[model samples]
Structures are given as C-alpha cells and as structure tokens.
Target: MSGDAVQIPDDRAFINFKNECNSEEGWNSNCNKSGITIWIQILRRGESIA
Candidate 1:
C-alpha cells in the first residue's frame, strides 16, 4: 500500500512526511488538524504470488 497527502491545494503545498510523524496518530494530529487531506492507494498484481 502507498499513501500520499496534500497539506495545501495550491502550489505552496507541504509534503514533508518526516516532519509530521513517526507514528500514525502523530501524523493524523499534525496534518489532519491542519486541514490536510490524506490519500491512500493499494497496489497489487493480478496474478497470485507463488
């Protein structure tokens, strides 16, 4: 799974993940509280791994 976040919608958006968190809760509080929206994407192969 991969994830992305946009702190701001305009050209001046901030995306420094390291600065936000080392934990999920920390990131949520830091980014979500500040009006950032988080996006997640899951990548998988059509064939099973054998």
Candidate 2:
C-alpha cells in the first residue's frame, strides 16, 4: 500500500484516493479533531502483502 499527506485549505478539506486493486482489498480511515485531521489507507492481499 502507498499513501501521502496533503494540505487542506479554508478550515476544511475534501480528499480522494484512487488506485488499482489486484487480488486485494483496500481500507481507509480519517480522523478530525481540534482543527487537526489525519487520513490513513491500508491494502491487503491474501496473506501476502500490499
């Protein structure tokens, strides 16, 4: 799996993730608190790897 960090503008932000899935499933999560936000992504493939 691969990910990146981005800057949000105007006290709010919209983010999108695009990728290809090959015999694997992807997961994502986001958190927001106290004017701070974090995003995460995880990819799993069979018991092998991302």
Per-prediction backbone clash count: 0, 0
User: How big is the positional error of residue 49 in model 1, measured in Å on the Cα after superposition?
Assistant: 20
Candidate 1 local distance difference test against the native = 0.44
Model 1: colliding residue pairs: none
> Candidate 2 lDDT, tens digit per residue, 19-48?
243212454437778988564565456564
- All candidates: CA RMSD in angstroms? 15.0, 13.0
lDDT of 1 by residue, 1-50 (tens): 55886555443333445534443442223234467767433336684422
The CA root-mean-square deviation of candidate 1, after full C-alpha superposition on the true structure, stands at: 15.0
Off by over 4 Å in 2: 1-29, 46-50
lDDT, each prediction: 0.44, 0.47
